[model samples]
Target: MIEIACDESGADGENLVGGNTLFFAHGSVDVSVEFAGSVISEIRERIRSPAEEYKANHLLREKHRAVLEWLLGALRGRAHVELVRKESFLVGRVVEVLGGEGAPSGEGVPEEVWGAFVRAGNRLLRVRAEVDSGVLVEEFFGSLDALRSAVAGTEAGEMLARLSGRRERAFAYRASIPTLIPVLDPLFPTIVDTAAHWSSPGTPVHLVHDRQTLLTPARVEWIRQRAEARGVTLAGLRLVQARSDPRVQLADFLAGIARKIAGDEATGVGDPVLGELLRPYLEAGALRGDGARKG
Candidate 1:
């Protein structure tokens, strides 16, 4: 079975909001251990930084620009990065949970108007008046509530009126279900995507990831099941410390740099050249900035 080494940066679990980082980036490398070790040794020789274990920050500096460029170009073919915006995810969940499956059609209002309101609802959640995640979730629900007036006398209004009662119940149920909370964690989706990417045909892939508290045995099984459902074969998942595995450390470097690049792009401050270099590896389907879609 082929093996893929993986790591992540800015991982805040499900606590995307009120978390330390603005973006999460997951990286997977399909390189051999020997290749990873050689890359690390080359960097140690080039930068000559006294740090025992090298990190992304070490190469991100202006002085190391040349090495960073060399590193990105070298791993272009084998490394892939997945980027996600936390708040935008919540806005999407708002639409999925409360917006219902099928689109609404009625004499109450035109379908076009309904579409506008849906977009508006997403915008409402994207605009954060509060920093507290709990309050942010409440505000998301409240944004739905406040829209009652905005969508009044329209088909969208009727739909919101119906979902009004379910919001509180949804919140209450989520609180009671402990397992549901972990499932919301972004790491799970990133893992599933990495597994799916490497799982070729009938050949299952054994995924080696950096040690993370969230990668419990049960969760690893869930990742396998999820991968299978998506037509990907996962042999199994194994966790190792970054120090013990050079491959995992390399994955960390890619992830760390990717996260920084994504964050810079979100805020409109970054080296344009470097951002373009990492662009090809960044997942095309992840939500962009705080609320826009990317491809």
Candidate 2:
């Protein structure tokens, strides 16, 4: 049996950059159990602060980067991380630029152009703030119209049209899930599938997630049913406080790190240290969506 400890970060309204992490250990002879404790201790000592403090601050500091790097190195092959992030603001910007409610009006957009639009949108959002919602909305849409007209018949316009379809699908899926579990609804099944992929044939997996009020008994049952339908052998699923479990603490750290990295990426910032630590797993395609998960 394998024990998976899961946790998520970035649920606050401003930072939609969030994801879940799974810290895996074989039920028998798992070395991660001990390694987690040592890593936690080392992290605590390095930061001169409690684990909870690091989590609360979103672990974005250069000082904390090394500890996070160490943690990632330790869990390199043992954990699976998954992140689901949506830049609604950027989506909105794209909608504005293309003269549509969502997506561009033309054909298809190249990935590079889409990326540039997102980055430019991020910069714009960052620089202009503290404005009335009504005014902001008006300005945003107006800007979109201006951009659409200016770029009409240009390469950028064509690229925006191409990118619209994909963005529309993402927005559709984002709208379907309950707002409360926007991150978890899609995440739960993906994690279960990941566990099944890593487990021995016919082995039952037990899941333990950091306690959340939203993950009621009914929700757990729903996840179990879905996993069962998918032929994933789920022996049990329960919620526990991270304080009582070192593995859960590691999960929390992983989730927090993933969120910060995602937020940085959306804003066009880079953290070389964190990037290097994650390079191996990323190259192996271990991360799902914006989060990290075992492949």
Q: How many clashing pairs per prediction, in order?
A: 0, 14
lDDT agreement of model 1 with the native: 0.72
Error of 2 at 113 (Å): 15
* Tens digits of per-residue lDDT for model 1, 122-155: 4333423234445545554565566665668777
Per-prediction TM-score to the true structure, in the order listed: 0.78, 0.58
Question: lDDT for every model?
Answer: 0.72, 0.52
Model 1 bad stretches (over 4 Å): 99-140, 147-165, 168-172, 178-183, 285-295
How far residue 38's Cα lies from its native spot in candidate 2, in Å, is: 2.2
TM-score of 2: 0.58
Q: What lDDT is reached at residue 213 by model 2?
A: 79
Expressed as tens digits, the lDDT of each residue in 25-124 for candidate 2 is: 1111123667778876777787786335446253457666656666677777776555544444335444443345433422254444444444444433
